[model samples]
Target: MRERSVEHEGRPADPDKRTLRLQLLTVRNRLTADDIEEAGAALAGWALKLPELARARTVAAYVSVGSEPATRALLDALHARGVRVLLPALLPDQDLDWGAYAGEGSLTQVRHAGRMTLREPAGDRLGPQAVTGADVVLLPGLAVDAHGMRLGRGGGSYDRVLARLERADAHPALVVLLYDSEVVERLPAQEHDRPVHAVVTPSGVRRFRTG
Candidate 1:
């Protein structure tokens, strides 16, 4: 995509980050239901075989909404294997509080900010610190570059999640789920940004040395 540098006449215009996010969102919105389904199944095939997930006793993952690559199959597969799965519940401050995933029926639709509804766990909230015990953390992102820098939806929620893990000295295998097309050559990075350990796409898994 071309870099957007033009500024609006009357306003202090858009930054490169905002421009990139809009571009990626447009691409994501173009994905069809069938495309998402196929990618989700393929992603499960690649992700389930990873050693990190296979060895994980506790996992932190999320439910995919809208045009994002589906995580329903992968989530179910993890739960079926008796893995302790944790899903995030959005807090008023935009930080995440985790809860145990009981099953498909255990999730409830929670409307947040009057913008989007999230499928969150219906059980008790485990607090934000709960994720510190996870062996692996599956992140939702718009794209991940070769350097494992993830382009999130600009909510800054996961940024806090990563920060919490860091403050706790937790070292879980951080992974991002995306479609093959979302694996890009490069992405803009900020100082607060953290690198992921791997990215699981529809085609395969790409590992990175985050140390």
Candidate 2:
């Protein structure tokens, strides 16, 4: 498949990360359904090529909402492959708890008062520590830097997830899925930031160093 390499303009490493995040989100909000569908299909194809996912017994992943790069394709693909896919359920404090992904029907739309609606598992709740068992984790992000620092929606949910993994000494191969244009030159660093091991974009898969 031919990949579109339209680099996003005005993508500076702005010290005010909020500005950079909004810039990326604004562009993503403009994507058409066709654009999202095509990107989703290509992303699934490219991500499945990764051995981390293929060999994983358990994978921690999230469902994409709205104009973000769709994740339903990848979620279904992973479940179909017999991998125990765990999806997140948001806690009142913004930390993530997990639940199994049986299929599309297993998810329910959950609306947090001040947050985007998330499709969470309709089944039993697995504690936050359940993520420690995952062999790989597919994170949702608006952008990732050349250094693999992921620019999440600024909710700080994944920050907690990453910290939990660190505290527990769980070394899952963390991966971010994004549109090709969202991979940028740099991102403003945060004291609590953690790097990912890989990123799967519409164009291809990229490996990064993570400590």
Candidate 3:
């Protein structure tokens, strides 16, 4: 992951998240429950088709509880296919750790920095060198454009890690997961921002090659 430059100025203020939440709620209503389920199936199908996903020795994905459907489909597919998974572990220092996910039963909710994460203790901390060998990294974000520019939750943690990956030249391709409606035509961009290589939605997956 790369470091964020100049702080994430694009994130809306607290009031903005509130407003976005309302808008997202409206969008959610437009989608029937069955539609989301079908989309999840479609997303999983497309993800399994990716050569990277099929061959990845190490796969990283988020734990989605409420609105995040992409993670569920991805995690389930990877587990069924016997691909190794590394889930995010919150550290005391505001950094992320990679740990093996045993199964759905292994997850437990734990509070960290006022947020909840599915805890799965990793034996030891993984260094940059260790993650460099990963084949693909499934990124979580609110929105992503076809260019792969992503709008995240504003901590810049993911950006920091991605920056490190860029310097190491061992960076795995980034895939941002978004609901179909979250895919926008454009978003605010900054010089420090790194575009994802792909955007996976419930309906389908779109590839974005970088120069």
Candidate 4:
């Protein structure tokens, strides 16, 4: 079946995931522009302090959209640090291609068919395998539990990226950026689910045990 069909399923239609995503998205949608801006700045600051990003030579990340945490600041900061930042360009099949982020001017608004508009790179496509070369991969997620389990937006794009990382034996540090409230007590996980190494929120950073 299609990926959108399982967006709420959270793997086998788990009610826990459905409820958690709904709750998280609702809060995100209600966030005021100022709330999002302030949170984004705070998250950028905390993420910059990460030892992983400081030491990273190549990082794979995505741009934030709508009421999501402000990633533009963080993205600019990383680029200014002379870090090689790779942004994703979604393919037609819901897979992602890689591209270099030069600056705000390098991005173009893309209205994907039957999906939301995304600010993607207006540059060359480096193909999906480019992610294997990254030392760090910043993921976009709704919530993450203590065990590092992430509740994604149900597009299954990141899911495919995770699987690709596994197949390539790419052990880059996986990190999720979120708001303080998104860090919850628990999140249900599945057998195929992979754990993230760290989460950077507006308040602070939290590390988890992952293998």
Using lDDT, give the best candidate's number. Answer: 4
User: Candidate 4: lDDT over CA atoms?
Assistant: 0.87
lDDT of 4 at 196: 96
Question: What lDDT is reached at residue 43 by model 4?
Answer: 96
Total residue pair clashes for candidate 1: 0
lDDT string for model 1 (28-107, tens) is 89989999999999999999999999999999999898888999999999999999999998887677899999788989
Candidate 4, 148-198: lDDT as tens digits = 988887777888889999999889999999988888878888777789999
Estimate every model's Cα lDDT from 0 to 1: 0.86, 0.84, 0.67, 0.87
Q: lDDT tens digits, residues 1-211, model 2?
A: 0000112122333357768877887998899998998899899999999999889999998887777788889999999999999999888767788999999789999877666677899999989999999999999888888899988776667877888999999999999999999888888786778999889988999988775
- TM-score of every candidate relative to the true structure: 0.92, 0.91, 0.79, 0.94
Candidates in descending TM-score order? 4, 1, 2, 3
Looking at model 4, residue 66 earns an lDDT score of 83
Q: Model 3: what TM-score?
A: 0.79
Worst 10 residues of 4 by lDDT: 1-10
* Reference-based TM-score, model 2: 0.91
- Residue 107 accuracy (lDDT) in model 2: 93
lDDT accuracy of residue 60 in candidate 4 = 96
Q: Which regions of candidate 3 deviate over 4 angstroms?
A: 1-38, 117-129
Total backbone collisions, model 2 = 0
